[model samples]
Target: MPKIIEYPKGNFKNSLDLAEAVSSLGGSCDRESCAHKMGLKMSGAFGTKIGTTAKYELITTEKGKLQITELYKLIKNAYNDVERKKFETEAFLKPEVFNKLYDRFKGSELPVGMLSKLLIREYDVEEKQAVPVSKYFIDGLQYLNLLDGNNNLLDYNKSLEVEDDYAEIEDENDLPIKSNYSSPYLPEKPTAQILHIENKNNTTNRVEAETTDFIVHIMGPGIDSQIVIKEEEDLLIVDAMLKKVKKKLQ
Candidate 1:
């Protein structure tokens, strides 16, 4: 049981970036040369990305060389598109962040904004950074078909059943993290009618005006209520508070 790793941020921008970097070579390669070939500066940021790769069991260091693990080699040399997807799908689940998130909230749904704030609390991530992390997982997971159209992790009984090969994805932190060390989740920026919907009614999102009517759902610890949002002046008040929150973050 490999441990969960903090989501990595650096040279590899996204999943595709990571896959591309990993696919560029075979056998063992010198870390310095590999980093140089990747057009990334030899810095902690680059190391962070490599560390993340190792954490996901994609690459392992032998003596002074970075060697692709058998599992990763399998993913890269997948016989066909379907095999590639199967391996790639299993690869994402190896991260602690994804597993914990799926384990924590497999069925509930909420707004992207709220999820970003939750990441702030759970992982000590800054408000601004959490937004992108949320967005990455939000879009990436769905793109990988792990999450459905509604952006929720599909269940074990769903399309993706846990494969036995999943056990091979291992690294340090080989244990589930404490529950208290977590926060809620959602993406920060959703441009087009953005809403972090999970298909469950546990939490509802809203952002629309009906000529002169709107529905407002308020959620808090042990307190939940729905209010109608209609007055333009009321929208102003909400807008002002939003700025205040942003100001506080600044």
Candidate 2:
């Protein structure tokens, strides 16, 4: 049997922040260059983070330096919001860590503590390490609107639920292929996932009162845009944390 590949979470604040920073870079650089551009110190922790990014192929190392992958550049150069999100979805879902986990659990709700234990048991990682890795996995996936407000998984096909105006959201019953690759951050499954958000405001004309709907194109393992409209006040992060329409369990 293939061993499950494992990697530490990179020190990019969060995966999305790291992607944003890399996009800001001129498409290629080293660890030092990456740190400098992000205005972060190139300490041991930073080095580990850089390594993590490379592990995922978001950035590659050449002659002991780093360079952005062509896929990521496509995302950075995307002409529109939905297209950019599609690239990001492809990048993240490329990792076996995301696919296997999503396959095993689908999009069911899971808390950090429980997930940590699963990691430890499945990969035989140290309990101390498993907890943090679990957190990283959950935190990173949030960038794609894969998780709900209470940590429940909203969807797994990497399908972002946009407004009804867009194509209908994908069905979670469509499961992904379980990853059998033993390499960390390697692509082992199909592409297609999600990232979405909805926002609202308060105004006299009731501008803020109306619900704001977003439409995104999920990349690898892609699916139709899933929709999840939120109340205006609940949309504190309307633009950031999008929305999800979970399949009602029987």
Candidate 3:
């Protein structure tokens, strides 16, 4: 028998409610306490709320306790609407299935009429759950303004760019990175100490930066590539490329 993929049984708003409840109890509480805070009884229905909040990556169950995640705290304590919405978008897209949908239909009109069929056919959504899952996904997009009035999905990062002069950034190390552009394979922050050794033959001096938050776009005749390094592990790709170049030169 084919494996049944897991999805949030409740909608996005319901999950948010569960998150709020978890927050009310000092960000972590026992299952019964959390359910009571949400005015929900200790039952399977309440379990679904917990499960759905977890699906959005807002809360985690640790040692029989439901705890709101740091993402949730960031959203709850966001200083401005833009910051809040950015974190909300992150929460909404946390699920693997939801991320898959966003990637497939980003900057394109959602197939509203055929979404259910598409979900089941392409995304492994169960036959019985295709409709509701599609509905919830669309609802989340609408709530987060990810879906525009004409049904075309907005560019996730472009829509959330923080407009500012940024002329005098307080910390030189804190690069202003667009949240959506972050890679899942990388650590959010990487720390490494660099040792510089002077060589008589080399005149180049290297300046080390704390993080890699820029995109490397290479375009030439019949060649187009975009390289994004969000963590130290990603440097292996660059190292391999340099090795190839050195071999060719040798």
Residue 98's lDDT within candidate 3 is 82
Tell me the spans in candidate 3 whose CA falls farther than 4 Å from its real position.
1-4, 162-250
Clashing residue pairs in all predictions, respectively, total 4, 16, 0
Residue 28, candidate 1: C-alpha displacement in angstroms:
1.2
> What is the per-residue lDDT of model 1 for residues 71-189, given as tens digits with 9 covering 90 to 100?
77787788644466667656665666655666777655534557777666775556667787677656656666455445555553333322222222232122111111111222222
Which lDDT tens digits does candidate 3 get at residues 164-235? 112222322233222222332323453222222234234243333443564443333322333455554445
Angstrom error of the Cα, residue 154, model 3: value is 0.8
Model 1 clashing residue pairs (backbone): 3-173, 3-174, 115-185, 115-186
lDDT of each: 0.51, 0.52, 0.68
Model 2 per-residue lDDT tens digits across residues 1-250 = 2446665565323444555576677665666767777789979887777777766567777797667788767876886555766667666666666557766665566656678777767766577777777766776667665666666665533333332212232443222222121211212431222232122222232223233544232222323323233332122222222322322221
Whose lDDT is greatest here? 3
User: Can you tell me which runs of candidate 2 are displaced by over 4 Å?
Assistant: 11-25, 156-158, 161-250
